[model samples]
Target: MRSKIEQIRMSKKNTADSGIDIIESPEALASQISRAEIFFIKYKKALIGVAIAIVAIVLAFAAYRFYIDSQESTAQSALSNVVYAMENDSLSQALNGSGGNEGLLAIADNYPGTDASNLAHLYAGIALIKQGKFDDAIDHLKSFSSSDLLVQGRAYALTGDAYMEKNQPEEAISYYKKAADYKSNEFFTPVYLMKLGIAQEKAKQPKDAIASYGKIIEEYPLSAEVTNAKKYKGLLEGEVGE
Candidate 1:
């Protein structure tokens, strides 16, 4: 039975003769393809329009990217100059545009979409604060946003300082708390905590102020502010003997 089945399968395979064959005549295939081309030619204008549209979109995107790059470069250059002036304590020059050169304010105004522009806003706010323009400083500082915890903390602290200078103790305390809570690391954290405690004291919240100071003494005992924090905490506690 197995032999008969094998012989029958071989006879079927011989009859079918399964093998791929290539077209021997190229001209015949070309003519067939040419007939298909004539059908495609009917929609040639539509296809060309789509291709042109795609090319135009690609070119437009490229041009937009180039414009953004140029703007970023210009903004960065302006920011560097402003930073130099700021570092040298030339607050006026850093805020206001120098002769033929844009300042931080100008970069923030002209290149609103760039990172440099955002940083310029921060610089401008700091410069304005230094110049005793608290309202203007708050305006610029609030407009600036940053994901970096350190920079964000600084911005919040500057805003708090401006509020305190303006005699708005509540707003100052709010910002001080934000700065104190943000990214509770060793460096800025203790300083902001001291500021927060002082602000709380100013706000007439002695208990809260004591708590803030105690937090500094407990968590950041080695910080520079710890000594002051301990003093303030003791004073607030009003413990006479021990």
Candidate 2:
């Protein structure tokens, strides 16, 4: 009984013996090798074209990354100045065009695709609201987006303020509620709840307002809003009874 490996070897030997040698001589083998070489040489340009295409794709990607980095850096530099002005409460310098430097508004306008520009939209909206441009503030704030919990919460709160300023109590209450609920934290939650309660009250939803105030009283007893929440709760209960 032959081993498996020996059987495979003997089978291959028998197959080879049964086959006719088409290219028996060294010269014929050389000719066959030369034909293979000719075929490769004929398609050499196509292979080189593929290689060039690959190289071009890599270079194009590198160039795209470089462009993106440059744009981001430029946006960051411009945004930093706007943020400084905003921090200093220089609302005009922060929102309007600041001569050659470009304020938050301009950066948000000119570089719509960048992260810095997106943040600029948010800051610009806040500045517009502070400057009493409620309509413009709403436009900018609506365009702004952020993944950060605090920033998103602040934007929602600011939107509520803008709506409140525009005499849109219903919209204000909705935004205030959103701010209070989004990523609720001990720091901003109580403040947002207070704003929500106030907005709800202004919107003539006394029951909802009472609920918001009760939430503050129950969840954030140590908050400054807690005293006001309890007082408002009592007032709302009295109103309901009458």
Residue range 107-161, candidate 1, lDDT tens digits? 8889977889899889989889989999999999999998896999999999999
In model 2, what are the clashing residue pairs, if there are any?
A: none
lDDT tens digits by residue: candidate 2, 74-95 = 9999988777788899999887
- Number of the top candidate by TM-score? 2
Show model 2 residue runs off by greater than 4 Å: 1-65
Locate the minimum summed-lDDT window of 10 residues in model 2: 17-26
What residue runs in model 1 are displaced by over 4 Å at the alpha carbon? 1-65, 239-242
TM-score of model number 2: 0.73
Evaluate all candidate structures by whole-model CA lDDT and list the values in order: 0.87, 0.87
